[model samples]
Structure formats: structure tokens, C-alpha cells
Target: MTQTEAAPVTAAPVDAETYAQIVQFYSHHMQLLDNAEAEEWADGFTEDGVFAQNVKPEPTRGRDTIAASMRRGVDRLKGRDVVRRHWLSMVVADRVDADSVRTKYYAVVFETPAGGKASVYLSTTGEDTLVREDGRWRIRHRLINHDGA
Candidate 1:
């Protein structure tokens, strides 16, 4: 093998119980954001978690910054009396290590204004790094790519 090419690492697949827990974790995590519980949603991340979107120039790093960003979006939507719902599906996870997993999922967000019909607001696919911390799953990093972008 060439020195430049790295060898693959062997790791066990995430167990059934652990995989189920991860799925459940995403249910609550996405709901928190959809409900505009910015602070609470951010609490699901590690202290140095990162959030990145393809449309954005740079990823937002740190739990505090991520919370602040969510708060702003929540406030803006609330001002317009718009409610957002996130529908996440097609979750696939691969174990990176005993404590970390890489997840890929599809998310579609629908928004409804106070007096308007619901419409699709955004469609994206995301890959994230999740870590088991203190007996719970927390996002270590997230990378989202807009379906159109």
C-alpha cells in the first residue's frame, strides 16, 4: 500500500439497542428545534459542537454560538407567526467507534403562517457525528447540504 493511502479501520456495527436509542434521540432533538426550543435544542450538543450548512460561508462552532443562531431564526419566524415542522427520515448510522457514530438523514421542513397554508420551506440532507456522553447521545458535529444548493 502507498504511504498516502490510509488503511481502513475495523469497528463493530452499532448494536440494535444502541441504534434504537440513537433513533429516539433524533426524535426529541428534531422536535426541540421545530418547537423553537432553541436553548433546549442546543443543550443536546456537546460543548464544542459544530453546525454547518452548505449555503453558509463558515460553520458555526461551539454550543453557545449554535444556540444563539437558532434563537435568532426562531425569533424571526415567530415575528411572522410562522410555525416550522421538521420531518426527518431515512436515517442510516455507522459506528465510528465504541462511543461515536456517523449518521445520514433526510429532513424536510414545512412552514405555516398564522393565516396561510402550510408549504415546504426547506429540503436538506445531513450527515452528523454523534457521541455518547454521560450515557446520552449528543451531536458532536453536523453538516447539512441544501437539496437545491
Candidate 2:
């Protein structure tokens, strides 16, 4: 009889590190949107992924659709300057599988008029599903649930 020592094995990967990456990505995304960099923001998603502004309606599929929706919003506020901010918090990401993750977060958007006369607010919470493709993570689906009228 012979006995051999087994090879050293690493610990099972925790979801925390991956969740942190997703949180960082979301922060970057918020910055991009705040700067009105729609094209850059749209680049965060996969080719066939979706961005849903509202939960009731179907998501805006593809980068083109997402970009177009962003463009329309940007164009609507063209002349009159408006600054928008997205406050995201309480991000919860779970590893659904080896290459898939699900996350939930709350978003509060505040907007100020050019003259600073009045401020408008809209808040929503969202569920996001992400997938790792080619060693990179991209948002696969997003569903936003608005909290107000």
C-alpha cells in the first residue's frame, strides 16, 4: 500500500469579489450617464442585452436601441441645461451560476434645472442579471421598478 499527498487546492471563490466589481462598474456607469455620455454608457451592456427603463414594458434591446433611447432623452433637454444624478445603493448580487450573476439595487435620480429654480426627483429600484462572456462581465438584463408616480 502506498499513500500520496493531495495537491493543494484553493478556496471556493466567494461572490463578494465579483459583487464588488459589479458595484464598481455601476459607479462608473452612473458617472458616464451623469456626464451625458450615452454612447459610453450603452457600451456597458452586451450586444444582445437589454436596458429596461420601466418594468411594465419590454426592455430596449441591443446597444443601438439603448443608445437611441438615451439620445432621445438627451435631445429633449438640449438647450435648457439640466443636470441629472443617479444615486444607487444597497446593491445585492448573487452568483446564480458559474458564469451568471443576479443583482438588485435602488436608484434615486435627482435633477436640477439650468436656472436652479426647481428640482425634480424620481426614484426606482432595479434587478439586474449579468453574464460573464469571454472573461468579461456584461449586463444581460435590467428591470427597473419605479417607486413613484
Candidate 3:
């Protein structure tokens, strides 16, 4: 007898309203990060959310910790006249439940220094688990996998 592996299960298609809400969520998230609104960006997550990167072994958990980390990064760039933008594309979302969604998207981080042309600083893929809390979609867990990693 031979053993065979089963195929992965795909999520069901979401309704128009759910799809629109997800798109808006991503847009607002990107906007907050690009504008260096660390606190606001962190607020997009649940109280006990987790943010992990492929390059790092440990994940950042909780809103306070997440906000602090973002603030530190912002402080490090305080003296530099650099503009950072997060461009997200190829977004695919799966509904986990009526109030939860799982999504994956491609991300490109572009940086423009002073008057210089914009260049790609990082390219990565992100997997996020979002849940509706208090009538808003908030990220419960996010994993960022860097390109070529």
C-alpha cells in the first residue's frame, strides 16, 4: 500500500461587504504605517496580538510592545529625511468565521531619501489573521516573510 497526502483546503469566498471591509482595513493599515503613526498602527491590532518576521525567531506581542518597537524605529529615522511607503498588493483573504479572516498579501517597502528617487528597501509576503473585535477588524497575528528568506 502507498500513502498519499491530502490536498490543502481553500477558504470560501467572502461576500461583497466582507471583501470591501478587508480592503479598507489593508488600506488604512498601510496608510498608518507609511505616515509613521506608530500608536495608531499598533491600535489596529488586538490587545494580545502577535507580529512576527521570518528573519526573527521571536515575535512581538501585545499592543504596548508593538507600539514601542515602532516608535523606536521612528526615532532612529528622526534625523534622516527619508520617506517610507508600504505598498501592498495581491491581497487574498479567507473568511475563518463571520468575525474572523485570514489573509495573505505581497508587500514592497519603498524609500525615498530627501530628493532622491524612490527605491525598494524590502519586499516581503505577509500572512495575517484578523478578527472582529468591538465591531472593527483587528489583526490577531501577522507573519512577515522576507523575500528570498
- What digit string (tens of lDDT, one per residue) describes model 1 on residues 1-149? 38664323323447789879988998898899988999999988899999999999999999999999999998888888888898878877878778988888899999898889999999999988899999999999999999988
Error of model 2, residue 59, in angstroms: 2.2
| Candidate 3 residue runs with Cα over 4 Å from true position | 1-9
lDDT of each: 0.88, 0.77, 0.87
Better of 1 and 3 by lDDT: 1
Judging by TM-score, tell me the better candidate of 2 and 3.
Answer: 3
**Model 1 error, position 96 (Å):** 1.1
TM-score, every prediction: 0.89, 0.81, 0.91
Candidate 2, residues 53-109: lDDT per residue as tens digits? 754457688987888888777777666688888878887677667887777789988
Better of 2 and 3 by lDDT: 3
- The weakest ten consecutive residues by lDDT in model 3 span 1-10
- Candidate 3, 11-113: lDDT as tens digits: 4666778879888888898899878899999999999999999999899999999999998987777679899888887878877788988888899999999
